[model samples]
Target: MTPAARHAAAIGILDRWLAGEAAEKALTNWARTNRYAGSGDRAAIRDIVFQSIRCRRSFAHLSGAETGRGLILGALRAAQTDPATVFTGDRFAPAPLTDAEFATETALPPAPSGNVALDCPDWLRPLLDRALGDQALAVLEALRHRAPVFLRVNSLRATVDQAVAALQAEGIDTRPAPLSPRALEVTGNARRVQTSAAFAAGLVELQDAASQAVVDLLPLTAGARVLDLCAGGGGKSLAMAARMSLQIFAHDIDAGRLSDLPARAGRAGAPLHLLDDAEGPERMAPFDLVLADAPCSGSGSWRRAPEAKWRLTAERLTQLCAIQDSILTRAAALVAPGGVLAYATCSLLEDENSDRIAAFLDRHPDWRCDLSRQFTPLDGADGFFAAILRRVD
Candidate 1:
């Protein structure tokens, strides 16, 4: 498909998404109905749609409207490209820009100030400001772009150099990420990773560098028993399994989420067990380390799931904080005396990170938080927060 046609397709999909359809679901529905769009076309269109979502506010300001047409036209203008080129009114292309849209003033980049410039929701701005303080603006600005793809080299299977070489042989170039010794930031052919021999062989797994860094901070002892309390898809569970000779058990509230973990663990050749029953963790209690990678606003990884940024509400955030609190409590109960209860989230909000830890400490007077870290887009990966709380009693 021509670039113009792809933009037109993206505009349609974005409209569906803005109208409350989930982005991925909308993309999938579009692909199923529009079989004429090839794989490359679908991918290109998805990128455009996601990019528009990431900078929705800024683009809306530039185009003088918040509709899909406005967003695509504004994206073109932001990149210093004339909207007329893509909106040619040709067959399969977007309709020609109207007089209002073609105005020179609106064609300029969005104002470099306020929520529009930051692309942050107004309701959440004060929370981020209070949490991030002086660096709030810079971090918010950093989030208005794509996130880098990072792979965790499965040290259980291959060395960093070996993994890089294997991936390079399959046309996927990677360089070691500074965030973690086991992390490799994919430089090229990121899409081919799943099909590559290295991935199938479990030499590496797609994970964020900061996520890997969170695992890097784990004080894993040889032969220690670890439980990923909220092992959704088992990314953290696999990372922990590869870290050392640990007995890794994966569990999630929704067992459906752990369905893929067995195959993944097998491929990685890691000894990862699944506690399918809700009572399973309690039965296998007193683990040396328990990681509760609880659900949250997902603000840190918004670039990958931009629609979520606009969809999150303050009430929902409060609900997530309460859930995080519950997760910490449950995970703490399974930790061995003197064991580590690692609470983590892919959220930058203090309410979900530091505040949760504080609340946990307040609730459990015997537990003490010894280490904590928060990573933002400024850190070159998705924002993540990990706190190590030791069960002292």
Candidate 2:
């Protein structure tokens, strides 16, 4: 498809997304219906859709409207591209800009600062400010762009150097991420990772560098019994297994999320025992370490899931906090005497990170937090928080 055709397609998908359909769903539906759109076309369209969403507020401001056309036009202007190039009303291109649109696009003033400029929702601004202070705007600004792809060298199968060599052989260039020794930030040809020989042989797995850093910080030991309390997809569980010889068990409240973990573990050659909703937590009590990668507003990962920031509500955040509290309480009970409970979230909000740790300590005097750390995009990774709490007699 022509570049103009791709933009037109992105406009339609963005319109469906604006109408309340999920961006991914709209893209999938569009792809399925337009079977003739090649892989390149689909990828190009998807990039346009996600980029538009990532900078939605600023785009809206630039175009003076929140519609799909406005966002695409704004995107083009942001790239310093001529709107007339794609909005040419040529075959398979978006309709020509109206005189009013032309005026808006040409005479567009600089976007207002703060929330809109950062693409941060108004209600979330105070929360971010309180949590990040001077870095709030920088963090939000980072979210307005795409996140880099990171891979964790599965040490159980390959050394970091070995993984790098194998990936390089496949035309995927990577450089070590300073956040974690095992992390490789994919520099080029990231789209071919899944098909690369290294990935098929379990030499590397798609994981964020911050996530690898979090796992690296956990209190792990060889032959220890570990429980991943909320091990959705078991990314951390596999990472743990690769880090040391651990008898790791995975469980999630929603069993469906664990359905693919077994195959993933098999591929990585990381042995992981699975627990179903009816079975784990109580029956498998007294684990040496329990990791609750709790669910949150996902604010730290807005770069990857931009719509989540726009969709988050105060009520929903409150509910999530309550659920996090409940998970802490229940997971604590499953900890062995003197074992550790690792609480983590992909959120930059204090209400979800340190505040939750404080509340847990206040309620449980017998336990003490050993370490707490927050990772932000400034650290070359997504925002992540992890705290280690140890039980004492």
Best by TM-score: 2
lDDT score of residue 56 within candidate 1: 97
lDDT of 2 by residue, 66-97 (tens): 99998998888888899999999999999999
User: What is candidate 2's CA lDDT for residue 325?
Assistant: 97
Q: What is the Cα-based lDDT of residue 202 in candidate 1? A: 94
Instruction: Tell me how many clashing residue pairs each candidate has.
Output: 0, 0
Candidate 1 lDDT, tens digit per residue, 72-164?
977887897877889999999999877766675454654546898889999999999988899898888888888899999999899999999
Give lDDT: candidate 1, residue 251. Answer: 89
lDDT of 1: 0.90
Candidate 2: list runs displaced more than 4 Å: none
Residue pairs of candidate 1 with colliding backbone atoms: none
Backbone collision tally, model 1: 0
Distance from true position, residue 253, model 2, in Å? Answer: 1.4
* Cα misplacement distance, residue 35 of candidate 2 (Å): 1.3
